[model samples]
Target: MTNVLILGAHGQIARLATSQLLQETDHHLRLFLRQPERLTITDQAREEVVDGDVLDSAALTKAMAGIDVVYANLGNAKIEAQAKSVVAAMTKAGVKRLIWISTLGIYDEVPGAFGQWNHQMLDGGYLETYAAAAKVIEQSGLAYTIIRPAWLSNADTVSYELTQKGEPFKGTEVSRKSIADLVVKLINDPQQHIGESLGVNQPGTDGDKPSFY
Candidate 1:
């Protein structure tokens, strides 16, 4: 069984991925979050919740012990700093595989009017920091697959498509469940999309903005 470290485990997508991992795979999970008490353990035998900040390199390094894969579902204005910490901790611990959850437009890959709307929505600080963070991961020399998801929804269905880094992003939005499904798929095959950045969106969701918006 592979040991997986999930940083920011309290987040919605992380929680979904955690549950799916437990139910679908026999991998052991180390759920790292600031408020550990907020997470309810579904399988104590395969899940260990750790209270620590990703920015704390020492704590991250400690949690990296025996970890085979690092799936980071973290965000915020200090994302660049967090990326640095994760890279450093993983490097020090000798772990190489990383699955990072980033957002669309990080590379301005979105096309047409939707791209402009996306910029209007996320340009200020969010996109800037996430792009910087992705840069850190790409240059870290780790076996990493960066997932840049389109606008997220709470839809229960798992329907999505992927576009490579240079390709214009497809569709308008994707469900959180879809992203979680992709994460589990990568964890099961850690080498699948190494050194590539993917843009994920729901099939037929092409529009100027998400249907919900």
Candidate 2:
């Protein structure tokens, strides 16, 4: 079984992916988060929770031992720093594969009025830091697939589509479950979409803003 390291395991999407992985795959998981007590272990046999910050390179490196894939669902204003730490830790630990969760508009790939709306909403700090973070991952020379998901919702559905880096981003929003589903798919076959940044959104969700907004 592959050993998977999930940074920011307390996040909503990470939690969903964790449950799905346990139910569907034989992979062993190392769930790394700052607040370990917040996460409830579903399967102790296949899951191990580590209390650590992604910014702590030593702690991150320690958690990477025997890890086959690193799925980082981390974010915040310090995202750029976190990316650098993850890259450094993974490099030191000899881990190659990474699935990075990012947000849409980091590349300004959204089109039309929606594009303007996205900029208005995210241009200040969120988009800037995330773009910088994605740059760090791309330049790190690791086999990585960066997932740039559209506006997120708590919807229970798992329907979504993808657009490549240069393509105009499609739709307005996608469910957390959909993003989780994509993460599990990549973990199952780490060879797919390596070195690519994908924009994910629900099909037919095209609009000026997310429906919830």
Q: Write the per-residue lDDT of candidate 1 for residues 38-58, one digit (tens) a residue.
A: 999989999999999999999
Model 1 alpha-carbon drift over 4 Å, by segment: none
RMSD of 1: 0.5
The residue-by-residue lDDT of candidate 2 on 26-114, one tens digit each, is 99999999979999997999999999999988999999999999999999999999999999999999999999999999998999999
lDDT of 1: 0.96
- Model 2 scores what on Cα lDDT? 0.96
Give the CA lDDT, 0 to 100, for residue 107 in model 1.
Answer: 93
Alpha-carbon deviation at 34 in model 2, angstroms: 0.5
The TM-score, computed over Cα atoms with residue i paired to residue i, of candidate 2 is 0.99
Q: Report lDDT per candidate.
A: 0.96, 0.96
